[model samples]
Target: MDTAVEEPQPDEFICPICLELLYKPLVLPCGHAGCFWCIHNAMQGLSFSTCPICRQKYNVCPSVCSPFYYYLKTMYPKTFAQREADIKKEEKDMREQSSPSPTMPEGFDPSSPASLFKCEGCHKFAENPGVPACGHLLCDECCVLEKCVVCSLKITYIPNVCASLRDHIHDNYAGLCSSGPLSSSGGGEVRDKFFKVEGPGVKIQMIGDTTARVEIDEENFLHFHLGCDMCGMFPLRGAVYQCLDCPEKVGYDLCSTCYELQKDVNTGKFNQTHTKDHKMVKRPFNVTKHHLILANNP
Candidate 1:
């Protein structure tokens, strides 16, 4: 009998930003897939959210492609495991070899939120630093907040942040749901979210984890509770409205744009039922990037 060694899968699983196995891979609006962190970092300081490969402007946030995910999970478990181990080892080594007693920039406040996370590039609190999927973020000040002094890793800054950071910044915007006469149009578009999507075609997975795209069937989208009933728009700019009396499927949800338009009830800009009579609540639209192939279709 002959023994054969396992080989790593094709480079499809490798992230262009870090040149490593995909970590929390997500599809960009341009039909390319990259690690969540890598995509986020690349989107910073650019006039258009252009894909690194095709230079297509990103119109909205993306989701993880499921077929690609299963290809790695079910088809190449050994490859996935080995890459994960390598990433962990690399991080450990970086942590040990990095500079010690790093100094903070002048006027650096010790009480700042990022004070605890020091950047090696500027020797200061790396406020909103871009964290690479495989290596680390350093000196992203030219592109975004915080100043990492490391300045060694080559990368860029992006407006889209990691799902974890978005969670902490949630609930800052207004929702479409209201108990009585509506308030302002959810105060215009929040523009805080990373992607925009349309109705009837979106394949939503309602899983709680925001780190990576979860693999689910198209039928699973039927159970999504956060869809806007009146509009096909997704949560790229803000949260979708929900109805207290009617189920999301029965036309109770409202997008922020529609909510603010019908503030007077008789304006007819967003002609809908008496929403003020319904009790509704707002939750962060914690959507992550979908798989690349699915993203192109969606």
Candidate 2:
């Protein structure tokens, strides 16, 4: 029996312009093959009219009809058709991808009103209309005002006055005086008087039924006292030396002999003195009295 021989397959054609498989094949004057669309696009705006493959100058374009075109058209018709179809499909897909989606919001659409809300307090445009308690908007004042919404108290502006209001009112009605006036009852009249004349720092007052005022000027070394004279007494070497004459608290100093005698009396050593000797007794060395002294240096 005789066997049938197999036919050789045709070689695939490539486009010279894109270096790819030829689709809608067109042949240049120099016999080079390329896709018709690719060649047309390349030559669209070019001034030089020539065959790209052989550089042969062409004064007028030639007819594209040729035997090679028919051969490719009949032999690989499906491949040529598929390539043309693919190019169209790819172009359609790119255009679809580039076009904006219908779901996306348009530029500055009025459907959402929140984008137009503005703050009333600061007169600044904002996304919300509500005013903050601090009376500041995002676009308005840089700093927030510390103010009470109900009372309208500017707390930040007058902090000291605001803080002192309650205390001042309370102390006024409560009858609670400061230490400067109260210490007078305790024979602090001299210190209190000195402090009043000087300023507000350390002061003294006497603690008794008849209040006395004692002011002390520590810087100037001055002392003053006001009280019933009967209560005023100087402490000399642990013994009280009464100021007999003065009605207000008065200042007194002790001599060396009287101070030694007072010390002996404090140690339980009694010295009997007649009325004449008592009148002639020398003063003690150290005497404790309400007097203003230099506090900083002392």
Candidate 3:
């Protein structure tokens, strides 16, 4: 007696449309495979003239339920049931996870007067208190005076206590803010600009012609500039210098046009000098002409 051999099953194929195990596989001319329902839904709105896979030009309609469906129903019945069960379980879990929680922060009494704290500047009681300048409390108005404590000159309003002090004092004192406004004798006004020089230090107003001031930092460095002084001109004219090696002119200059022209001239001169030097360096072996001839021949 002869025995029969069982054929290997095709259970690993997946449908591209539903992204599940293919229940009814259909192959297009381009050899791409998808489920029957996926292809039908995709072609329903569009003209039924293109292959669903390679999009090859074809006018024939897809064939109806064939041997693929029967094979799926008989061989993979358990797989289909398992996939449906997994989907239902996932949906149930999602619904449970989306439910709201019941909790609140400690000391969150909204109605209690004792829970309220006052703003140092405004003196108004709220849920929070405003702390400024080393735990010093001030009303919002005093905090936003927009004036330097040391000079009394109007400075830009920076909200933080440290930023305000830094702008007012620059980097002068170790801990204390400046004693509001330096006297004019130390650095008198010039061309509507004030200049203050103490020892090797110098402070100049880079902006605001009529009323401006300087602030020093903790390291005694003046880093802040205010106003539209100089109409945005450079601090000095002759401060700019030409480059030593290259024909490039660099450094700070007052006029933008003059600075740009100097840069262009310097760059051109540098390039010319570089080209001449390069040619001279290659003069010992006359190889440049031979290389050029070979390159041209190609």
- On TM-score, the candidate that comes out on top is 1
| Cand. 3 Cα-lDDT | 0.30
lDDT of 3 by residue, 89-161 (tens): 8548744211111122123244432221233234433111112211222233454455423123232222222
Report the Cα lDDT for residue 131, model 2.
Answer: 21
Candidate 3 segments exceeding 4 Å error = 1-12, 29-31, 44-52, 82-298
lDDT of each: 0.39, 0.30, 0.30
- Candidate 2 on 1-298: residue-level lDDT in tens? 6685443233336665676556544434233445545654555221224446545432212122222334344445566566657766864875421111112111222443222222223433332111221121222131134542322322121111111112222332223322212211110011111001122223455569677555543333221221111111111122223333222222222223333333222111011121222322322222114332322213
TM-score rank, highest first? 1, 2, 3
Higher-scoring candidate on lDDT, 1 or 3: 1
For candidate 1, write residues 118-160 as lDDT tens digits. 4444554333323431123222353243321232212222333
TM-score of each: 0.32, 0.25, 0.22
Alpha-carbon deviation at 53 in model 3, angstroms? 3.7
Q: Compute the lDDT of residue 28 as modeled in candidate 2.
A: 40
Q: Is candidate 2 or candidate 3 better by TM-score?
A: 2
